[model samples]
Target: MKKIKVMHIIGRLPVGGAENLLLTIVRNTDRNRFNLIVCCLDKEGQIAEKIRQGGIKLVCLGTTRVRHSYRKIRRLVELLRHEQIDIVHTHLYKADFWGRLVSLLYGVPVICKTEHGDVNSFKNKPFYFKAAEYLCFNKILDRLSDGIIFISEAQKKEFEGKRIKMKNSFLIHNGLDTKRFSSSNKRRSQDRSEKLSKNNIVIGVVARLSDRQKGQSCLLLAMRKIIERYPEAGLLVIGSGEDEGRLRDLSAQLGLDGSVSFLGVRDDIPELLAGMDILVQPSVSEPLGVSILEAMYSGLPVVATNVGGIPEIVRHGETGFLVPPKEPDALADSIIKLIDDPAMAREMGEKGRETVMSGFTGDIYTKTLEDLYVSLLKRKCRNRNYRYADLFEIT
Candidate 1:
C-alpha cells in the first residue's frame, strides 16, 4: 500500500501546548505508512527548528498580516496541487480557517481540524468579533470538516454547549514524552537536590506568561501568601508572553521578587520540572494543561485550576489538587497542604508519574491519531468520489 501523504497546517510553531503536541505526533508517527509534511501559515516560530531537524518537509508561507487570508488560501492551493496532499490536517484558528477553506476548494481527500483550545473562549469578546467566529469560523468548520479532534472531554463539552453539531468528533488527550521525562528524572534528581537547600521547597508554574488566560497574577498572590509561612519556598515562573513585564512588576509590588524567579521560554523543561517539588497551573481557562503532564512525568505533584479539561487530567487529591480558578487563597491553601506533608506530596508525585507513563505517553497518543486517520481515510474512500491513489498517478 502506498503511504498516505498528510500535510499539517498551523499558524506557527511556537513553544506552546498545541505546538509541542504536534511535534510529538510527527515524531512518533509510523513513517512506513504515512508521509507527514508541515506547513506554517505565518513565519516559523521557535518549534519550527526542531521539526526541520527531524528531517520533515516544512513549508513556511510567511503570511504575516492577519488580513492576508486570501494570500494564504492562494498559496495553500498551489502547495496542495504541487504536493498532491492526500490529507490536510489543521491546528490553531488561522490554520483551521484557511487550511479547511483551501482544502475544500482544492478537493483534498480528507480534511480534519484539531481544537487545541476551547472555541467558546471568544465568547467574552465584543459582539462583532464573536458574531464573526460564530458564522464564519465555527459554523463553517462544523459543516465542512471531515472530523474534529478535541484534546479533552471538557473542551468537547464546551463546544457542544455552544451547539456545535459536527458529524464526527473525537476526544484524544494530549500526551507527554514519558520515556524522555522518566530517564531525565533519574539523572536530574541528584542535581536538583544539590541545587536546593534542605529548607527550600520549590514550586513551578510552566506556561505562557499571559495573565488574562493563564492567571499568573493569581499565582503571584498565592505565592506571596505561601512565602509568609514558608519563607524559603520559591516559585519558578517559566515561559514568556505579552504580560511578562506586568507580571514582573506585580511580583515586586507584592514583595515576591526574592521568592519568584521568571525563567522564560526554556529548552530545558524536563530538567526544570525535575528540580521542582510541586507544579501549579493557575489558569482562568485551560484546555488540558500539558505542563501538568510534564511535571507528572517528572514525578512532581500538581495543583491546577478546576476549569476546562483540567479536572479530566487532575483527579483532585489523587494525582494533584484542583483549586478553583482565580482564587489566590485557595491556591495557597492547597500548596500549603502539600508543603506541610512532604510524604503525601511524594506519594502523589509517584502516582502522577505512573498515570502518565501508563496512558498519556507520546506513543499512545500517536497510535490513537494514526488509527483515526486511517479509519477516516478508509471511510471517505468508500463514500467519497475522490480517490487518493489516483492523486499519485501520472497523466
Candidate 2:
C-alpha cells in the first residue's frame, strides 16, 4: 500500500504545550503506513532539531515578517506539489491562515486545523487583532477545513459559544509518553530520596512565567500564604518567558526570595517532576493543562484552577483538587490540605497516574490521530470515486 503523506505546518517548534504535542505526534506516528513532514513558517527551534535527528523531513521557511509570508507561500505550494501531500494539518495562527490558504488553493485532499487555545486566548489582545483572528479562524477556516481537532471540551464549547458550527469537528484529548516519566521516576527515585529531606515539601509549577495568561502571580500570592503554615515548603517555578523579571521581583517583594526558585527553561522535565511533591497550575485561562497530566504521570498530586478543561481531568476530590482561578486563598487552602495529609496526597497521585495510563498515552494519541486521518481520507476518496491506489497518482 502507498503511504499517506501528511504535512504539519506550524509557526515554530518552540518548547511549549502545542509544540510538545506536535513532537509526540511526529515521534510516535506509524511510519509504516504514513509519511510525516513538518514545515515551520519561521526559523526551526529546538523541537525541529529533534525531528531532524529522528530522520523526519523538515522544511524551515526563514521568513520572519508577515509580508515575507507571501513569497514563502509560493515556496510552500512548490513543496506541496513536489511531495504530493495527501493531508495538510496546521497549528497556531500563522500556520492556520497560510497553510489552509495554500493547501486549499493547491487542492489538497484532506485539510485539518487544531484549535489549541481556549476562547480566553484573545481576551488581552487588541480589538483589531482579535477581529482579524475571528475572521480567519471562524469565518474562513471553519467552513473550508475538512475537520477541526479540539484538544479539550472547553475549547470546543468556546468555539460553539460564538455560534460557529463545526460539523466535522473531533474532540481528541492530548497525551504524552507516560512510560518516559515512569522510567525516569524509577531511575531517579533513589537519588531524589537521598538529596531531599523528608520534612521539606516542594510545590512545583511548570508554565511560561507570563502572569497575564498563566497567572503565576496568583501562585506567588498563594505561596506567601502557604509559607505561614508550612515553613519548610519551597516553590519551584519551572519555565522562562517575558514575565520572568516581574515575577522574580514579585517573589522578592512577597518575602518569598528564599521560598521560591525560578528555574528557567528545562529539558529535564521528567526528572524534575520526580522531585516535586505537588503540582499547581494557577492559570487564569487554560485550554488544557498538560503540566497537570505530566505531574500525574510522575505520581504527583495536582492542585489546579477549575477553569477550561482542567475540571475534565481533575475529579475535584479524586485525582486532585480544583480551586477557582486567581483566588490565592483557595489555592493555598487546597495545597495546604494536600500537605496536611500525606496519605491523601499519595492516594490522589496514584489515582492521577492511573488516569493518564488508562486514557492518555502518546501511543493512544498518535493512533487516534492516524485513525482520524485515514477516516477523513477515505471519505474524500469515496466522494471522488477514487481508489486508494489511485490517490497517490493524483496530480
143 Cα displacement, candidate 1 (Å): 1.6
How well is each residue in 278-374 modelled by candidate 1, as lDDT tens digits?
8999999998989988988787889999999888878899988999999999999999888887777777888887888888889999899888987
Model 1 residue 347 CA deviation (Å) reads 0.7
Give stretches of model 2 more than 4 Å off.
123-131, 134-138, 182-197, 386-395
The superposed Cα distance between candidate 1 and the true structure at residue 306, in angstroms, equals: 1.2
User: What RMSD does model 2 have?
Assistant: 2.7
Error of 2 at 141 (Å): 1.4
- lDDT per residue, candidate 2, 1-395, as tens digits? 57899999998988889888888888899888889999999988878888887789999987747667678888999999999899999987778778888899998989998888876566554465478676665457768889899999988888888757779889899988664565767444334333334547889999988888799999999998899988889999999999999999999999999999999988788988988888999998888878998988887888999988898888889989999888999999999898877777877888888898888888998899999998888888878775444745322
lDDT of 1: 0.84
